[model samples]
Target: MTNELELKQWYQLLFGKIDSALLELKDYDGNYYWDSVDPNSLRYFVSNIVGTPWQNHMGLSLLSVTDRKLSPQSIYNLMSTINARLKNLFAAAELSEMVEFNYSVVEKYLTGSLMPDHTDRQRQSFLTAYGSFIFNVSKWITTQFTNEQQSYFSKFLFPKLPFDNRDFSVRTKALDVAKETRKTETSAVTPQLPEIRAESHFRWNQVHRLRKAMRDVLEKARHDRITLPLEFSYDESEYTNERWHFVLWDKESFGRYYKVGTSSENEVFLEFVRAENLDDGRPGDGLWFLEILRLRLIGIWDQEYLEDNERLKIVEYLNQWGYEDAVQGQAPFQIRNPGLLTQSVFIVRNSRKFDKLLINLEPIYVACTFARFALDIITSSGARMNELLQISYDKNCCIVTVDNSVTPPSKNYIYRLIPKGREEEENYYMPEEVYRFMSDIVNLLKESYNSSSIPEVEYSAATRKHLMSKKRYIFQYKGRHINEFTINAIIRFLLHGTIIQTSEGNQVVLKAHLLRHAFATHAVQTEKIPIDIVKSLLHQKDISVTEYYSAPTHQQISDTVG
Candidate 1:
């Protein structure tokens, strides 16, 4: 059990720490208490992002309130339900009500006031608030039924009371949210600052790997390691193999271009891109300009210049050109090179920026660790970091293994295990990285087939039944990014948090997944493993046509290691 007095002081410290950062937020404002770094500021954020996303989360949030005559009762219900539950939680025994409390939460929703996503600007606070709400609801009910059981004889030990009723309505609300969500950018309702940076970092790391691959190809070509050019051009006879390295383009003005591709019948099909003519703008353009300038750019470049509107303007320019009539004898902008077009557009609104963040090493540590020790017992032993979040260890493995029988199946499909006491991966140790994640969560395994750690409600009967024969790993949440889907998501809450101010007055806590990328990359590097091993470890393979989906063995990584 947590120390009551210490915990209270801790929460007070949390509140005081966040409260000091905001100028507009009153000390007792209810918004600050949730997970967002700065709640007050988040109420107003700059939503300059322009696009028609399939499902616009920010747009729906505004429309959810704007479209409906959502009474204060609706908001009150959101808050009260959250409030009542928080009040009853055992974990927050020392946590008392903050100011305006229920009314503040409900008031915005009740009055149909524009409520941007609290999570955007105030991630931690929003999560804190969201968690507090969930914690309060669950804890209170658990307390009333568990500790104060006799007094609540009116209901069964488990209340069939419609938790799903509210949950279901939230699903419907999303559809309604979709319809009511405005397509156009609105100054009236700005989004909160995006707070999911940790996740964003993980996505960006994949881009880093791709960048590295491009660099390797270019460097090899430059060194005359191959006869071909850096980026092998389809029209190498006419176009030198040209590549765009960042340093070359840093000082040069960059733009987009449109190309006319030939179809089977030689029909012209126009294609648009955020670059100059393929033949004209490769390495030579940037390199040529840099040579003339004779000056290397000083100071740190932002790495992602594409986000700058000056660069992104190329797209919009193309849009305008589509409507432009010949001003003189031809279009206003001339193609410096053959039949190619170039305009300026660097950033695609709502398009993700590839800013690499730190990838936490913990989870990768977990998967590799398990693979190392379990190799002797398994068919072929190599682990992917992904399986950590959604792996389910089969019952047959537990029968002989004997060590991990009582573990609860995951809410998601994450389960993994090896044969009892076997640890040889093609006669080598599995990567050490995965061991760490497993070491942290291995304690939950039980002696019986019955689940001891996981809650059955989180999963469906079909899933649970499957896990009855399998062991499951559970992450707090799971999702996917570019290239591939992430199967397992464990320990999402485990991270160092940072705070940033929002345009409104909210503060948000951001995590470190870019760091995790660094960690995963470094881990493979440390192990002296090959890029393919890294590729397998990261689950980025799409060679799904044959049986390439199966991860390679330790030997593969070992042989490929640089």
Candidate 2:
């Protein structure tokens, strides 16, 4: 048998340590006391009724209950016996009033065990968890009660009781108050700062010209063995053949012609033939400039330019020069060299200052271009990074299919890219911008890998085989597959200064998941796409999953009503 004072001390030891731990939890710490640093931020080490699996170790140290002296089993048995009696009383309650009364008794015992110095947050948490626990346990006890026993208990528990007033929602109300208090404190300490403006797309505008930039970097990489931060190294190319390198048109005559072909050497010249001479193989009079005007750029490409109007003006200039015009006299119109497009754009945007400064595009700049492309695809498509990475050069497309049959697990199938970890393959069509950039990357990879100008490797067959297999994955770094961690790192580096202030005025890192939400929300709420289609695009098994992603734009509650 245990003394009353000893029992009370034991209860204090258990609940006191728990309260202390709860108070110690810091929201801004690198690691939270009760939470894990994962997507869910799941509460660990502590919960409403018990602690984590490792609680026994904590209990032993706190209680100082050694096996040589006090029996831990005896204390556990005593608590279990008390709990059994409480369960009996719980099972006997039939009426809501009786249930609430029994719950109050349990609450008194639990609250009595808490230390007097408990923090407000810890107190509120305890109350909320206690209420929730009572509500759950009452449900279990209600199931076991006989009709007659329940009636007896209910009648006695509420024997001609006078009208009473007690708010069961007090715990919830206290939580709201606690949250407001915390928010006010946080906001006062860290007021909202000015928004950080994004870097100009001057570099992104050079994506088309990035091919030359990459080659320049590779050439520089050869001479100096300059170590780039991304640790992966490029293998030596086959030096016996001259396949790796391509000759560039002189900067002076860069825009003389445009060539499109499957291979670098054998390009099919898209000649401008007059409508009357369409069937003939002969080229029309120096009408090559007409083809330049007909080139339709993807919408995203134009965004790389600082201003839409400026890009539009450039397009207009190219199109404004047709020979069919009534103005017969032709003036000498200077053709801007494509090689100096970036410099030309800079000059035009800078009030035609006639600045002769040349922009040297580095290798890091080329790598960032790929990173931006990856970000674009993931954000626009609402596809998982893994799913997007599964897209092989030849198999890139986007098509969604729906199956209604119950057998074989019915689901909406997104066709085109084969899903990672699934055996099934489907046909789909991707957005044009994605297709174009991804195809360009494929060509770039082929050129880099098969280039004869690079020396052949002196590595083992296993290493060679591994490098060859890396071709299967779209995102490769120096013959190795670039994983999700590297992609996220690249994104973080690119968006270093970006920040978003919360209602509490706390600034948080802009995560990739935010971009995922941006895609879904834009599709469902902004673009007003059908909810079912949104679900299909997101690859969510249930419509409810998409609802979280498509929360409505915030507005005052009063404004929402008439």
Candidate 3:
């Protein structure tokens, strides 16, 4: 019954008109205009152009289309308007028979083959709105409508769409490369051995010679214009050869050669040779070797074997690819061991524990004071580590609403981190304790620096570097602004002895999150705060996370029995 000619003509006409409209939206910069235009005119224009039941049926009439708009917001508003109309149409009618008809139009519009090319954000917005519409209408028709309607909705409307509804299950995969490496078996040719060996001194001396030889070999290869797969046979009489076999590769395949055992000699060879390739023969093997080389260089520098200028040159060369921390005194390659801090046990007890620690560690009063202040903020405000670091004093004590033009404005939290349009802010209300702490810190910083406006330091996205200001930080250690890593380290050090053994027989290391968990638990369980309130405080997306915190504790059970 459908006319192919008319369908083609209709698409052609709509495409031309929409393309013109999009052109009209171009601003002075040639970017799509985002200013408010007449939404009514736009809707009227679209409806008149489409010239079919598709307009009315999809609720093009109900669109609260704004006049002035930019790329994503413009597209989002249009889809939202269409979805609203679709909801009402599906709710009122028993269009069980028209499932295919409706879907064909939706699919065509969503594909936007005729529409002007738009940004990823615009595309995502359109897809999200369309996806939401399909899900909501399908559910309504199946549940509230007749049996025929349900069958049509379930069979045609739901299954035909090649996307998931919000109700579908999500599978998450945990892939930690480092953790997997620990469990992976070493090649038979390369046996794993303890890092520290009995012949560590002798091995280190051999390693130094090997390092120089490897560098010299690389330099010679560069001079000879030889590519990465360099070739040279080492004679058994190359050195004293006391440790193990002193030979290189066989000539035929030029295959990688190594000793069969897990001795210091093998380790040094493997560390140097394996740096060129992993066992599976992947590239980027040089990185591991480079790390080892840099560490050895640092050790040599630290032992004062190298002059200050020479040490500086070595550091600069190593840091050329951004391994500044590793080349420094910090052990960047150290594996993260799981902590033993538990939630309920630490929170109620840490306050007293921290107080005692402050007294004991009095020589470092600045670090201790900063820790205490940070602890108060985390416990009372429930801000995440990043959010806490980003917080700045505005000097405005009165509750104020934050209006973000790109997103919905919020009045939830007076003290909040306002990021750019791409991310959302979790506005939270500061409690009396947090407010007092802020006041005290602000006054202290003002008196110390003799300035009201304290400039906080944070990393810049453009250059990927930390930029600090001359003014003091609200939370600082040794006169430097405190970062998440520093704060976490401090928290661990403060609660080093505290341990919490879980029911699963695993130890939970006490971290800053333990304090957050404690705060959430106390707020939701003991204080009986609303889960929604808890979510806002914690800046969490769902009540489920807060529920985990509020789960009935062992103490609650014991008290109930008593």
Best by lDDT: 3
lDDT of each: 0.27, 0.38, 0.40
TM-score of each: 0.23, 0.35, 0.32
Model 1 residue runs over 4 Å out of place are: 1-108, 111-171, 176-562
| CA deviation > 4 Å runs, candidate 2 | 1-203, 206-363, 396-415, 418-423, 426-429, 451-471, 503-505, 553-562
List RMSD in Å for every model shown. Answer: 22.6, 23.4, 22.8
For candidate 1, write residues 54-100 as lDDT tens digits: 01222222223222323322333333333333333312233233322
Model 1 poorest 10 in a row by lDDT: 291-300
lDDT of 3 by residue, 304-345 (tens): 455676566656644543334424644222211111111112
Q: Which residue window of length 10 is worst by lDDT in model 3?
A: 185-194
- Between candidates 2 and 3, which one is better according to TM-score? 2
Tell me the TM-score of model 3: 0.32
On TM-score, the leading prediction is: 2
